[model samples]
Target: MMVQCVICDILEELDNTAPEAKRLRNRPIHTYMCAACHERVTARTNERIATGKFRFYRSSRRIEGDFYS
Candidate 1:
């Protein structure tokens, strides 16, 4: 399947049998990213993480209760 990288806007090809290709075919909302862009972002994220400040906060609720029922 032919897909374009949202970051670099480059056109690329993927095997039709690949899971990623299947996902894109099944879900239009899913976007594609080229390997170069993915690697660049990963390196930058690692750099920030190494600086001791980057954090990923999710939606899980904190349990304030200390006693069990």
Candidate 2:
């Protein structure tokens, strides 16, 4: 049996102006199913999450003083 892998994107909203839109615009959120396909969508989603590519950050703190001080 031959198995084929599919790629997809999961987003909250579909906005062309959105920053995420650019990256996932051309990608498919769902994968195609065919004979002998054992790949799970959940697995793929987990991989993406672990990569930090979909992380949300508000702000970062900085050290104003000198390191030696």
lDDT of 2: 0.43
Per-prediction TM-score: 0.79, 0.24
lDDT of 1 by residue, 1-69 (tens): 899999999999999999999999999999999999999999898798679686556433333122111
Q: Mark the 10 consecutive residues where model 2 has the least summed lDDT.
A: 60-69
| Deviation (Å) of 55 in candidate 1 | 0.7
Quote the lDDT for 63 in model 1: 30
Which parts of model 2 are misplaced by more than 4 Å?
1-39, 55-69
Local distance difference test values of all predictions, in order? 0.83, 0.43
Error of 1 at 27 (Å): 1.6
How many clashes show up in model 2? Answer: 2
**Model 2 per-residue lDDT tens digits across residues 7-50:** 33222234566544554445557433432333565566568767
